[model samples]
Target: MKLSRPLVLLAVGAVVALALLAGIAYIFKLPPFREKGEIKAGEVCSSLGSSSNAVDALTKVLPEESSYSFDENIDLRTDVTDTNFESSCFVAGGGKQLLVAKARLMEDESATSWTQWVKGTASNEVSIQSLTPFTAGDTAVSSSRFAAVFVPCTSAGKAPGGQYNLSVSTELKQEGNTNDAAARDELIKLAKNAASYAHVKAKCDMAPNLGGTS
Candidate 1:
């Protein structure tokens, strides 16, 4: 049918509008849309090794109305197995993967470079002072966008070593510098909470250092 010019334009506009809505839905992980991928309770700590995570549900850590809540969906892209697990979680904001947390088991007593905290304790590099919050753990680190904890996991890990280490990493995309200090401190706190969560779930031998909650 040969429609009038205005009518043709109106139809085109409707299609474009629908496409825009679809794009928004596809880009942002809107609530009630991807119910199957929802992050249930107690999932955040173990999210480093599982598809389910606590990021979206960590109101205590990320805040209920934080800008991160408006970011893209949670992506759990890792290689985990039934016995051993090594996984990472990321907030895929604007196509940039900002690591939120990664949990893994390691037997490398001399392993370093995983995080600034690990590197600093391993060596006395001059720039080691840049490790923002040095009180995260026995070996840990923190920044506006990073926090990691390496704890004794004699009972937690199923790996070969009778005694090993449990590592939990946390970071986020830095939106601004106005609150960098507070952000670094908060990340350090998050890392502590995450370490505790994993310790209990994984049946670790000892509690995390975490600089005694500050």
Candidate 2:
């Protein structure tokens, strides 16, 4: 059967409109409204590197008065899986002092949740004398005059169901001018900066404590 002129014209107009919309979308790179996720978390990180920003983050924490610099060879590495991401960097300063800044990302599951503060194991060989809370994470000061922090990145609102952990360890570093007190302070500051840069939540009022006496 032959089609009516008006009906054929209407059909042609609809096709042209669709084609024009498609061309506009392609030119402007406009994604459809019903893409996938709601673009939650603003921008979820993916290109977190090991030596790139990790080294800068670690170096920024070093005390200016201390005679320390990143060794000629920095032992830093990073890894990422479907459910986890981690970055670590080793720092050397004052001839015999060492510090490590590490960050971890994992699914926001109950068992491995990053919100709570967990104490580290301490024994004769590994003696964590004090465990306290920092503004951005947990702090542990060891008997060997060591300092560290375990931070969970939960400040960005819990939309994606994942958390972040930023840990700093100075247990291996020998006694130097920068004692546990100073090292602990530095680590806490580092954590605060990390929270801001990485868009994580931090509890600054939780100010770190030495747990025991002072």
Write down the TM-score of every candidate: 0.51, 0.38
The local distance difference test score of each candidate is 0.51, 0.39
Predicted candidate 1 versus true structure: per-residue lDDT over 21-104, tens digit per residue:
877876674532432333344434344322233442233334222133222222232222222435444554334443355566
Q: Output the number of the lDDT-best candidate.
A: 1
Give candidates' CA RMSD values in order.
Answer: 11.1, 22.6
The ten-residue window of minimal lDDT in model 1 covers: 63-72
What does the lDDT read for residue 199 in candidate 2?
A: 26
lDDT of 2 by residue, 82-178 (tens): 2233444344543543554344443333323332322232112432446454433443332333344454434234324444344434333333345
How many clashes in candidate 2? 1
Q: Top model by TM-score, which number?
A: 1
In lDDT terms, how accurate is model 2? 0.39
